[model samples]
Target: MKYAWAAPGAKVVCVVPLGASHDFGIAIDTVMTIAEVDTSPLVKCSVILRFQERPSDCWYAAEAFRPIISQDDDVAMFKAIADRGLAQNGIHVPSSSPEHA
Candidate 1:
């Protein structure tokens, strides 16, 4: 998947660098940032990611990860209804809270 499509809080799975053992499977993590790096002739951009159970950050090539698409129809329908209601009521709210800033 393209690195530009990745967003913070999006779920992704590592597919590259299978490591020493091939028996193990892919690792999943949440995207933190598409980290900026010096341009090079031989290397691609890297992405910063964090596992929910891990405290440290990890970096991997953008090509090494794939975005996870949600398959929950109920959640999608609920979000659509909520959005429609807000729009019909002329309500507006910030996407993020001030505490996050």
Candidate 2:
């Protein structure tokens, strides 16, 4: 998995993944999951990264989200998603993902 720095205090959607390399900076924070973009509908236990930890806000999107990231590693994860045509969009990686989602 690849990671980008998030600006301190910048709110982001964390994509918590199972059996993946986890982000060491946000391993024990609590976040809220919303079902919709503007709605605050509670979804699941979401974790937020601590601004004090790795405070450099950067959106982690599939290589499709160019200008933000690139598809370098063959197993970059985003590659497979792009292959399936499931390009755009990213999941919030809660601090609990086995690894950086």
Candidate 3:
């Protein structure tokens, strides 16, 4: 499959059984804001819960709670944390087969 595009973009689509739906589509919009983050100890990335369209729907889940991400499935020790949360909230992540070529 080939896609013709003009700019770089990233998105994650979640298919849940039943729950409130939200998206950050405006992330690709026209906005040039800058800031600095203190990555002194280490840069552990995490997905933040935020409502980009509504200023009232924004806040940190915790002062320090980072999820571990990995390319290998065996390295997914922390993946179940989010998976359980989703499952309990009536969300289902479709099972995927290992890709081999």
Flag the better candidate by lDDT, 2 or 3: 3
lDDT of 2 by residue, 27-52 (tens): 22223222212112352322223323
Give the lDDT ranking, best first.
Answer: 1, 3, 2
lDDT of 2 at 69: 28
Query: Which 10 consecutive positions of candidate 2 have the poorest summed lDDT?
Result: 58-67
Angstrom error at residue 10, model 1:
0.5
Q: Pick the candidate with the highest lDDT.
A: 1
Estimate, for each residue in 1-101, the C-alpha lDDT of model 3 and write its tens digit.
01111112212222222122444233312231111122223434332333233254442221222222236743464577778889999999876556631
lDDT of 2 at 64: 17
For residue 25, model 1's alpha carbon misses the true position, in angstroms, by 12
lDDT score for residue 84 of model 2 = 52
User: Residue 35 in candidate 2 has what lDDT?
Assistant: 20
**Residue 99 local lDDT, model 3:** 62
lDDT of 3 at 12: 22
Runs in model 3 lying further than 4 Å from the true structure: 1-74, 99-101
Q: Rank the candidates by TM-score, best first.
A: 1, 3, 2
Per-residue lDDT, model 1, residue 80, is: 82
